[model samples]
Target: MSPTPEPGLPARVRVHEVGPRDGLQNEKALLPFDVKAEFIHRLAAAGLTTIEATSFVHPKWVPQLADAERLFPLLRDLDGVRLPVLVPNERGLDRALALGAREVAVFASVTESFARANLNRTVDESLAMFTPVIARALDAEVPVRGYLSMCFGDPWEGEVPVDRVVRVARRLIDLGCAELSLGDTIGVATPGQVTALLTALNGAGIPTERLAVHFHDTYGQALANTLTALRHGVTTVDASAGGLGGCPFAKSATGNLATEDLLWMLEGLGIETGVDLDRLTGTSLWLAAHLGRPSPSRTVSALSPKES
Candidate 1:
């Protein structure tokens, strides 16, 4: 039975599934191109419209996705789904464009520490690097999405200021990004902080429609924070299938908000995501078997067959 509909929540939510890229990027074992392609196909089969397929970063950086060039062709035939790949810079953007990618996303950091650690450049420097990338992608008619990490708290620099995040977010918007995904990279954000950040962004002229939230489950607040965002009129929520993915750059960060778990909450609240929980859970379980482990998602665990 579904819970009573809330007054302020959005009628529908778009779940941006990030398992293929963000989830597998940090894995110790390298999966074959076929497996990766199958994973994405299965995700699309489960009704995920906007699936982050892979990253175009150099193989030296994220070796797991080195097969990006070969993997993309397999997904070209997937209809009615938006497969957005992550491009770290102009080079990455070039690769993605060459592959006929329809959509792309660039990762940015709001804090200097993570900016240096992850991208080896300061916050402003990283944005400056993305300037040309965003311009070229936009010129080519490819929609660009900006991912701003470390929005709430930074491991090196704790407690990010709302104004600082707003400034960077505005710059990304000004740089021709169609949408901005604010990431709680360390997953330390709570309900109140989520409200504060969304309000701040609104005050700075960034509408809720153009924004998405990507929360990690480090402090076990991913769901609570997501609910806060939904109430604030944010319709796009980022989650990983089976609770896979964390920042390889930020070791302190944990798995992302699980898609099955998020689906459970949304279904219970009478919110529509159009995702088949049973199929998605099965996909996670299949992947978990390939990776030699059980899924970390609570929903998957609860719904999986129990042992005798």
Candidate 2:
């Protein structure tokens, strides 16, 4: 409800934890359905209200999440949290609906190359594909979230035009998306680029409150880019705990900005996110132990007493 914080201080950013979905999707060892369920439970126990639980795309694409049908039901949001599952098409929507999902998400890239590689379709094709899916979700009373990847830069497409971004974004919100998340997929965005994009979106009649932001830490620009977006009035932010996410298709790209780091910044800025920073650090630690890798979060790094 309040504005994002200024530089060198806290931010009003609301961090959405994506660890259960993004973090586990790329894992080499597939966790059992129960493990995934418990992971989501612990995330909620830590005071994170928004948790991106799983994707409903076909099993052939991401075999790790093939059990999403089983996973979603197990992690059902019976209370106190919003669990948004990723749905890319009618079939994904059907799967989400069958499992009693209250919210769903769809994605389209800001660049042609990324769109083609990520979804095997052109940008417009991807947007067109979601028409029926969005319609179905709305009909079923399921909230739909739109994810626009590579909002700032694409590895193969070079600099993305602001007009392209605005055009795609306008279409998403127009099509019934409850929220639009601008993603710097390969994390090539600078703070200035973030500001410019958000400014244009605001001028395009897309309220800052309706737009959310997702940033990768590839070049260590995620936090800075997040700051720029917040200052421009964006509130919802997508982050994975312990920095537990990355794009398999994008070369050299790193994880999403860590949830703990974002929470640290938000708490400092006096934003009331209703997230427990200490509990968040604990979840990050538990996850790092499960994954056997160093967490990529600065706040978790400072909080975790475990030897490096």
Candidate 3:
């Protein structure tokens, strides 16, 4: 594949849309299954090839996505899209497998505080637990994506070390994850920090091709960090439609890098993401109305035509 228009970027970037699952998970109002299904359908129709549909986590933990079992069945008609769901443990993986999930994602944090708060396990313990889960997914022929949260900074621990992040990431990749998504959970990462982290990962021999970046727009640095990652040759990026979803564990964490926002930049840079920005913006606008608030995405706010 050719490099992107930017001197060192990839020719085409693959955007992994996490809106339906991630976006709605953080909402105060619980949407009906039909509404969630429609949103997923609209997102896929807007040219997102990989849309994370839902998570198989226990309802007690995240009441919003308790409908995962019911939701996946309704998404069968979305034929060509890859709908990966988050599976936090063996039970979650089992639930996903029973529902015929072809791709699943597992999440862990680099900081011990985050690991304990989020999963009730230490960083090492969480990694140990995922080993079996990842093995099971691989045995079942399902591609597993490992999500390393708190890659740049942690709310409880402050600035996270790059080596700590790299160690956890290496462990995940070694444990059979097909790809690793480094997440700035608190949205506190700057472009310089992003560069240093990627550089360290590269030095550790993990090619950018096996990685994706997940950034929060909390400090309004998501796009800048994404641009740095793209320059480093990382092609896959995780974004939520309509700027939905925030870290429940991190109080200061606001929202993800919006799909519309990322699309606007990609479109301007002449990068082929196969996404229709106009259609995506329309989706966000519709979702905003349903959520009873304006979208946080600058691109969506700027591009959406006003009602007469």
Candidate 4:
């Protein structure tokens, strides 16, 4: 038999930090607006190029994001950084646009069960609703990112089919979305599953380079799964600082993978995240102390220096 080619080098991955928005939103105490701005400032200082700042979801739905109108302008005009927010519908997009939001993300769920619960709309209905939102953004020369939740497993449904995931990804790409972020809303994906999904997405001519992984560390497998995704030539993994965030409608724990942890693994693997571990970990520790709990990331906790 002919010799197989050596395992080629993996592509460089970009970690978009989402901690300031996703990380702090779920906290019961609800961080003050100033603290939220500071959190974002610290993340940018830590060298994160992209950060999902906040969502324009109604205050009744997610009270933590009530300050979106105020926070967006404060963070949007920062020099040399991209801050995108989650806009649920046309109304939300209107708010974001009025705030001069150039980049925004539209979120939907892969499974019908997740869609109904998260957005109170069916899969097709949600897509139909987002069509105008996407169209308007494109017309305005704005960049739009699509988010697909429960690409792996859902709390209500045991496991989602691979075909379903592929279809949703294709739809999002076809909707003029420049990028798609696959979300593990329940945090149940294994390394094998991560590889399989990315492989399928790559095979479908869906441009894996434009893909981003939004993992939840519910089972503590977020970092390991990230390694698998990186190996499969998938870049732009999303992470929240202090391992913060959880889905409101989703049943299981769905906190995001910690930025500090993701950076630790990437650096150890000789991957360039351009994020400073000490500064990030320092911020993580500082935030945790404010929240009055230890962080969930093993890497962050392991490399965490003594608090002075």
Candidate 5:
């Protein structure tokens, strides 16, 4: 067996906050549009430059974010913030464009099962679906993000092939996506898997600078996987405040890597993220109170007083 090759880590990382879109999507109790808007504002004020605001999917698909149009307008005046919304298709893109979204994201799955379950299409079909969406966004001078879910493991297929992930990722980049976010949807990835995946992607000519990692903490490896990504030169990571949301299609998928938890590790390593840990923790606490549940973030739990 060969030891994993360590790449030089970046001096700073960009944490993409996905709480408003991805996090709230899986919640049963749909928050009001004002609540969601306030949440995004709080996240931005806490120094999250890249916050995924809302998804332009049909209301039938994700009722929690059905107020996307209304919600986006409320945060239009937020300064120095990049609010990217998820667009599932051309119609979704149309909705986002109507809302004057400057950035948007499209999602696909690396595995066939997840692709079908999540997108109701095959892998190739899903990519083809996003082709026009990506093109139109780029034509409109809007930056588009590509989300490749089930990169490491799939709920039905178990461990996914690294080659498949790389192939899908390359296609995404070729389709005009400005950046790609690799997701550990079920959180079954270990550090070794993370390194191997990134190495394979790098070998396929996908630079780390154009990639982001999205990890779920189901198997308690989100932080470790993130560390491995950092060491492999990936500077962008996807996290949710309060560790909210899971995959509705993937039954085993759990909460995403918490922003507070990721921030703690980065700050401890003296890595800059321009995010305030205390303020982030408070934001999580406020969100937890709204959700009427304790945060799943270990850092938030550890930092809060008994009374809190």
Candidate 6:
């Protein structure tokens, strides 16, 4: 079934598949290194070009990804895929660099509470911590991606002002980040808020091309918010397979926008994502079986065979 095109939207969208890292980080079942590596390989086989392979955060912080060292080596043979790892600080960056990571991302929060809660530092202090990390990564010829969480609303601090988000976003851009991913960490953003924030960022001299949207489905607005972002010229989107992970720090947050769910909409809209929906769905189902549970994705549920 060919999709009818929508005017004024991007012809192609880059799906930043975060299932391996963001999706699995919060899972209670600790998968082995081989299973994790195979999951990534299957995702790439499904045509996801850029996959966030894993995080280099301390084992004490995120024990699920404690095997970053062992897991990354197995993926060194994967060709034509961008496996960007998450680095929490200088030590995380060093671990990624030691393993020949071509790209890395640093996470940040726009609110003081989340910054202190997640990074154990004030907003300014966290940025200061990332300053050298971003610089060092750039010096090593590795592009840095900055993730700005709580762009719309926060559980600790409600109603994040657009101007405040813009200020922090600019600081990240100035810090030499190649791209910035605006995260709706708690999934409280509406279409109107999405428009306002993107407009404010554009007005503040941040090009739409340099920005990406990461929405959570807590309010069931992740897809709508994502579409609004696409209308506003944001081509890069972050989604997790099977709608799997949430912010471990923010209890109110739900799973991220599912890759299968997002792919359905993009395919229906005639927007090119280059992802094989069937293969991706199969991968999600496979992972779900391993976790001894069913997937949370609506699209996956609808497409999956019914039980007798």
Judging by lDDT against the true structure, name the best candidate.
6
Rank by lDDT, highest first: 6, 1, 5, 3, 4, 2
List, residue by residue over 104-192, the lDDT tens digit for candidate 3.
99999999999998899999999999999999999999999999999999888999999999999889888999999999999999999
Q: After superposition, which runs of candidate 2 have C-alpha atoms over 4 Å from their true positions?
A: 1-12
lDDT of 6 by residue, 39-65 (tens): 999999999999999999999989999
Q: Residues 1-308, candidate 5: write the lDDT tens digits.
A: 12233446677899999999999999988888998888888898899999999999999988998999889999988988999999999999999999899999999999999988889999999999999999999999999999999998887888999999999999999998889999999999999999998898889988888999999999899999999889888999999998999987888989999999998888777788999888888888988888888999999999887863
lDDT, candidates in the order shown: 0.94, 0.84, 0.91, 0.84, 0.91, 0.96
Off by over 4 Å in 1: none
* Candidate 1, lDDT over the whole model: 0.94
Candidate 3 TM-score, true structure as reference: 0.97
Model 5 scores a TM of 0.96
In terms of lDDT, the poorest run of 10 residues in model 2 is 1-10
Give one digit per residue, the lDDT tens place, for model 4 in 1-308. 13232244253567888887777778877777877888888888888889888999999998988999888777855788888888899999999999988799999889999899888999989998999999999999989999999999987887999889999889888889999999988899999999899888988888778898999998888888987877777778999887888877775866899887777666666666778888888888888887878888776788777678
Q: What C-alpha lDDT, on a 0 to 100 scale, does residue 157 get in candidate 5?
A: 88
TM-score of each model, paired residue for residue: 0.99, 0.93, 0.97, 0.94, 0.96, 0.99
78-102: candidate 1 lDDT, tens digit per residue: 9999999999999999899999999
Rank by TM-score (best first): 6, 1, 3, 5, 4, 2
Residue 40, candidate 4: alpha-carbon lDDT: 86
Q: Over 4 Å off in model 5, which ranges?
A: 1-8
- Clashing residue pairs found in predicted model 6: none
- Where's the lowest-lDDT run of ten residues in candidate 1? 1-10
The whole-model C-alpha lDDT of candidate 2 against the native structure comes to 0.84
